[model samples]
Target: MADTYKFRIDHHGSLIRPAEVLNARARHAAGELDDAGLRAVEDEAISESARQQRKLRMSVVTDGEFRREDFRGAVLDTVGGFRRTGGTDKYGRAQWVADGEVKAGGPLIADGYDGVKAMAGTAAPKAGLPSPAFLAATCFDREISGAAYKSPVELGEALARIIRDEIELLISRGIRLVQLNNFRYASYLFSRGGQPLTLDEAIAVDSIAVDLTAKPEDVRIGLCPTHQVTGTVDRDAATRLFAGLPVDRWVLPYDKGAEGEADLLRAVPADRDAALGIVDPATAELEDVETIMQRMDAAAELKDIENIAVSPSAGFADTAGRAAISADDQRRKLIHVETIARMCWGNEL
Candidate 1:
């Protein structure tokens, strides 16, 4: 396990401001702002986001994704060769989902350096990549078959190239810790009647991308299961699957009031440092520190205290127009993190 303490926030800004940003970009591109003017706005937004990170006192900050047009939809749109088809959401909203076979786009990097520079103002800024599951859910349909690519592997390799390019771009921009967000990893295990890859196969696929993009010391892999407290993340299985890989950190969902929380803690391997998600980022419900302390105490007995860090279960909740957390709530959360950090590194528990 790593000896030095570390912490991170879930990447959720895209979810927070997707509609507004996307629509704004569309309008800008449609002549609300000339090309030079639009670029200036993007630059300003990136700079402001970095300043905000410094104010938050976060060790690592993301670009706030102000440059992204859509959090989930843009990746699919960028990858060429997909046919758009009409689909209905569970709520019966008319939605368009990408289908049909497609050729992968060659490696393309984000054009904005202003955002990267802004995030690097004080704390280290790391670039983030969307997980394959998030990409696949939004873009790839199992029904689509391509003559150019016989399997998802062919397509995935192309996607991996683009991901690698993005990582390298971040490194070039002076960011060290690149986080790959793959929320769909475990969800595939429960897919009914789908040709999803097995656990070993999925690990292999992840390994390919990781190997291509990151040096052994420069990256951290962040995995999120689809649902909170799923009983499918086996520590021994993951240990075997990830053995000898240059993994620096591991993250998993730790939802409040979930039965799988205890099981998830038990499954975390003790050899690698872990981010124990205590707050749920998708909900507005504030966490009680006493409850979090109790959970951490239980988890500490399962995994070594030295191997843990405290953070929210995922990124901030996507609730629209939600009020920011109160200063007292923020202080309590920070106190919980500090207490955990002290216990882990200072042995002061």
Candidate 2:
């Protein structure tokens, strides 16, 4: 609670990966390109992405998550002990079971941070880590992970430790803003969908993950809730996550409409920032800036304008080569967020 989290304009971490990065990844997967060659392509693309965010004057900048296939790739690709089941879960996410202890193979997303740090001159570099609760729900297979982890909670605890390590590494490298991408709580707890962990259990799992060793003031941790495609939170779940979690920011989904989410918006702690998902990222249509400002005005009524932030409903690209919005659309959407923030909060943005 250092009160250091000041970003009033934000976006979900992932941005659309350019074609060359995706093509290079395909070539690397096919053994046609080596690691160094693939990284070179990724680096160039990430540099451009950082430059664009800096250009947009976003207070917080990410590497566009270009190094990751999906946001979870930061952990799934770098961490060891997961065995691919060659199939997807009910949610359509690729299944990676815990065959052994979950542990990091090396630094997770450090290279991406390096790329951001080198290019994001004045903006605070942000790191996107997958939520342990989300990972546990999606990746923990009762049959496959049973030998390695007695329960989904057990797997989640392991993931929490690994994520804690990554957070430590990130803070040490001077990265201050860390956002956890979560969907499980919204899907199961908020929407009342069937799931492995209860809402309380999901929050407990995530709490363990963000129980960082670094000084709480040293890093600004946020949680962005998104369904695979579209989702929203019930008041109870929103209240629980916003009040119970130790994180400093909550990037909530409001693309469906802010009126319905007004009560949930009240759940955010006064000390934490509420980043409204005013623009829908799953569509190409740019949000009307006036309408977005009205939403911000509504949010301001519930919380201080300093505590209000704005972002897209979700990431532009959750996976490679599968963004619903065009590059121009993504840029415009972010610009809309910036514009809305300025109009609503003025110089605070």
Candidate 3:
């Protein structure tokens, strides 16, 4: 049988000073840094990030995503052959990007995967592979004749193809867990009329991705409602949609609290597990132990108590340093990690 539960943390996997790298790259491209100097800086940052992950005892360490200049916006920028085009949005005229004009394919991962494998091989943890969160808070839509692809079936298939390549690469490296970051799924659901997708449409999109990337016995799928959405998870809907799928796990947003836990308890089958985000990743405050216990207690009432993992709502640190939290913030974050570990492991709370 699959493990009942597991706990892990997301290491940003990006260099500590991403903005500096970007600025330097822009300068280098603009004839500032010499080629040798730029290469030295890149190598140094990559080395440092690996060292930091080991120091932090992070089980599933990422490559600090240093290779990519921007975590959220870089996909559009770095994917070879893609070009930015003007498009309209709810606000007004906007810039829309796509890959057709530049190339018929997506980003190649062979080199990037090799780099991660080399780094991970040296600092191999219990979990030997890195969890690359793809498609986080973004949608893959193309314009044909000046119209965005809005049909769920068409869009989902296109996304599935891209995601499939990523899965194949990770699997090639013998990685077991592949987390596809899909905040856009929830965003689309809550936009405007509050239900951009019907029940069938949502199920279709999710199931297609899961089927393409994972075998019925091998994969764990994570989902979260966008911040714009309110209320608990749609338990009945989730149960219906995910039933008989390979989704062995579910991860919900932290703020959903007791009601959200209950919803997951009902939605996830007894055989599967749930990952609860007890601490908010957006802030530096440590989660109160007493409060987490109450929430876990509520979850225990509904599902197997052993099947719970504690973690943050998203990655520990944001790619954009706008938050500017300090070292003290990381200390508090560690406290939340400890609290969840004790609870999930059934130690005294």
Candidate 4:
């Protein structure tokens, strides 16, 4: 074991939970439980999730985003000018859609850190939100947003201010780590959903979104450049994205197709750290420590092992039932990550 390493499960922005919390949410919707009744259960659920993370011996613990449904929509819900379609998809999930003029809303992170921190105990408390880029790209309607702002860029700046305000809240509450999830950047690059901006445009907007000043080193900022670069990694685009980002830690998505992406290490800003995602989050496939070591070895070819951290390629419960893995599987995955951190970085075997 190398005895010193950094590991985070990734800010999934949601947590897999026991049936109690799930049932509470459903009942609250059905009017079977009052708001207080529902919130009590949510508190319990967040505490339990923190317990699980601590049990796994994680030095840093989060509330598992147990309070959010769609991480993206949750942030939008805090901002004014959007509504959830009363209609549900065939999947029955309530879709929060943007159909109104965007208005200045209340502080988005208000009381969020207080609650998550209250339950996390002595473990380092962490919290994250869906990125500002994801918010603007997915929620800002051209006709609707145009009515409220001079231009899309103006709306984007509004979002950056809101997010920075949220970061200030997190810092003030003594919360150390904050993550902004930005997988859509990768999705837009590879998938049919056109990216919200050109690569250069995105780099610019993203820099604004990520800009923050924490009072202390313990209050670190991180970002996840989601795992959507399909087939093979686009070295030029991906490198530019990483290099341009100013986060202290860069959470990169590299799972099944990561072999060709080893050069990603070469692109990581030397001043910024990396949490290399080596495990598959979309499948229940168990990665033996050897498999992780092989990926680590590949990364070592480009940068020293000390230069990187380790985690699941993504959060296990990012989209709620989307990853399709059992909760036990997530536990095992965390164990695998923690175990490998020890073997590879804790000390010599």
Best by lDDT: 2
Off by over 4 Å in 1: 1-5, 8-15, 18-23, 29-31, 34-36, 82-110, 133-138, 141-143, 188-195, 212-219, 230-246, 317-349
lDDT for each residue of candidate 2 in 1-349, tens digit (9 for 90 to 100): 5235677678888999998999999999999999999989988888889989999989888988888878888888888878678997564667777777888877888755778888888778888999998888888877778888998999998898889888888888978788998776666435767889887888889998886655546468888765332335476777777788888888777665534467667878887777778888888787776676777777778888776777887888887788887999899888888887788767754
Which pairs in model 2 have colliding backbones? none
Over the stretch 202-316, how does candidate 1's per-residue lDDT look in tens digits? 5555556566533545345444443355554455554554353334566655646565566555655566666677765544456676777777777777777666666665544
Segments in model 3 whose C-alpha atoms lie over 4 Å from true places: 1-43, 69-82, 85-95, 99-110, 113-152, 187-199, 212-229, 255-258, 317-319, 346-349
Compared with the true structure, model 4 gives a TM-score of: 0.87
Clashing pairs in 4: 1-346, 1-347, 2-345, 2-346, 2-347, 3-345, 3-346, 3-347, 183-226
Q: After superposing candidate 4, which stretches have Cα over 4 Å from the reference?
A: 1-13, 85-105, 114-122, 187-193, 321-323, 347-349
Per-prediction TM-score to the true structure, in the order listed: 0.75, 0.93, 0.72, 0.87
- Could you give candidate 4's per-residue lDDT for residues 1-349 as a string of tens digits? 1112243433334556567877887888899999899878878777777777777766567777666665564476567767775766553556654555555456675465555566556556777777666666655667666677655555666677777777777777777777788766765444344665566665666678666653465566778776533645566766778777677777776555454456555667666777777777667778766766877777777666665777777776665435468888888877777787776667331
Q: After superposition, how far is residue 88 of candidate 4 from its true place, in Å?
A: 7.8
lDDT of each: 0.53, 0.79, 0.48, 0.66
Worst 10 residues of 2 by lDDT: 225-234
Model 4: lDDT of residue 314: 70
Q: Pick by TM-score: which candidate is best?
A: 2
Error of 4 at 35 (Å): 1.5
Give the higher-lDDT candidate: 1 or 3.
Answer: 1
